[model samples]
Target: MARSVDTRGARPAACGLQGLPGAWRAPFLECAMTLAAPEPATPMSAGLFADEAGCPRCSWCQATPLYRHYHDHEWGFPVVDDRRLFEKLCLEGFQAGLSWLTILNRREGFRAAFARFDAEAIAAFDAQDVERLVQDAAIVRHRGKIESTIHNARRVLALRREFGSLAHYV
Candidate 1:
């Protein structure tokens, strides 16, 4: 289903300062503050192109290119496959308390650490893997998040087996 972009109620005309009473005008302008005008809606099929400024906002990417790429290319679009969904979820977990840039700078390390984010491979990660990851300088070395990633990978795999795809679960 195609979603409508609602422009209604999003803009207010500027008050003509010359004609308004000073008291009424300052209050009006202050209250009338609004979001910057939205760009024309893009086609839905453009994949993640809808929010390409990458500022759709995920708590972590405050002001960085990595955050931009992730938001523009990965966040919030529908996912219909299991492995890909699991990968994103795993990354989101890693981003739980840290800035998105921290994880993003280590994204390549993350991929390598989690074996390209393959569900089966990640699910197989054990204490040894966790230990190796702790020693790795590429990714954030948080033990709890690391453990949770593996646990979540297994859960996603189970969901895929039962539902045929994680996207369907969503």
Candidate 2:
């Protein structure tokens, strides 16, 4: 006995796989089916709100351009680079009592002060570097957070040696 799949009125656009070659259909469908669908938005749901462009977004990211850009481009995306992973960990530590937006705004400054989050470079940071960073107003001047970042950098090196990369360890 043979069962046939009904293909009546099926449009590729509806499946979001339009313009893909026929060979991709099966794999794409398989992957798509395995992922959970997002919940439908409701008027009472405070989780989502429309931006000025009418695109629905998380409510917290609507306050500024930097937040919106970060939400759209970086948030929720997986990062595999060791430096970026280290940067994220350091920033989250710095964000303990502050808004993420404040960190995002000064991200470039942090990068500059912390040697662009390079684990090897930051791992070498010493007392003089700490003093230099404390006087720098570009990033958070909290000595504890700065020290933690330097300490974490050394850990990152250890993780790299054991796990091959931070992404793999994570």
lDDT of 1 by residue, 77-159 (tens): 44545656677788888898787677778888999889998988988989999999988899889998899998988888898
- How many clashes in each structure? 0, 0
Which one is best on lDDT?
Answer: 2
> Relative to the true structure, how large is the alpha-carbon lDDT of every model?
0.63, 0.72
Candidate 1 residue pairs in backbone clash? none
lDDT of 2 by residue, 1-170 (tens): 11122222222243342322343232323222122223442242446654443344568877897987776556765566677788999999999999998899889999999999999999999999999999999999999999999999999999999999998999
RMSD of 1: 16.0
